[model samples]
Target: MRRALVLTDESARHPFRASLPPHVVRRANEVERMVPWRLKLGLTRKEAESVLATYAAGFVCTLAYFS
Candidate 1:
């Protein structure tokens, strides 16, 4: 994802490189790199997956509508 973002940034000026530093809220899963994050704050795997899934579905619907 990082690589893709870098490649996609058309401007020679790197915005993310200068400001908006990357912050890792929770380490992503090694096996499933697409997994968003795992909070140490104690959300179970099932609960987290459900939450992310809901957010993803909403986002997809929004994009589909706009597109």
Candidate 2:
């Protein structure tokens, strides 16, 4: 299970794609059960994907379901 932090226009940026914070990575990893509805994390699909890629390094996250 992947915990996608939904990105928004303001939160979207290229720098986030450079590196991923270990703490955040751990936090995302801890996410086991997914909620029924999407919870807003102040991010968008493109932005979330970029960050996940940066943190996981070659890791790909699907955006259909996110928190």
Q: Candidate 2: global Cα-lDDT?
A: 0.55
**Residue by residue across 1-67, what tens digits does model 2's lDDT show?**
9976643333324466324555654565475777533254767678878887787753334342342
In angstroms, give how far residue 20 of model 1 lies from its true place. Answer: 32
Worst 10 residues of 2 by lDDT: 58-67
Backbone atom clashes (below 3 Å) for every candidate = 0, 6
List the RMSD of every prediction in angstroms.
Answer: 15.7, 23.6
Q: Can you give the TM-score per candidate against the true fold? A: 0.41, 0.26
Model 1 Cα lDDT, one tens digit per residue, 7-62: 22233255553333234212221354455446545688998889989999999999
lDDT of 2 at 35: 50
Q: The CA-based lDDT of model 1 is what?
A: 0.57
The candidate scoring highest on TM-score is 1
lDDT of 1 at 46: 94
User: Candidate 1 versus the native: TM-score?
Assistant: 0.41
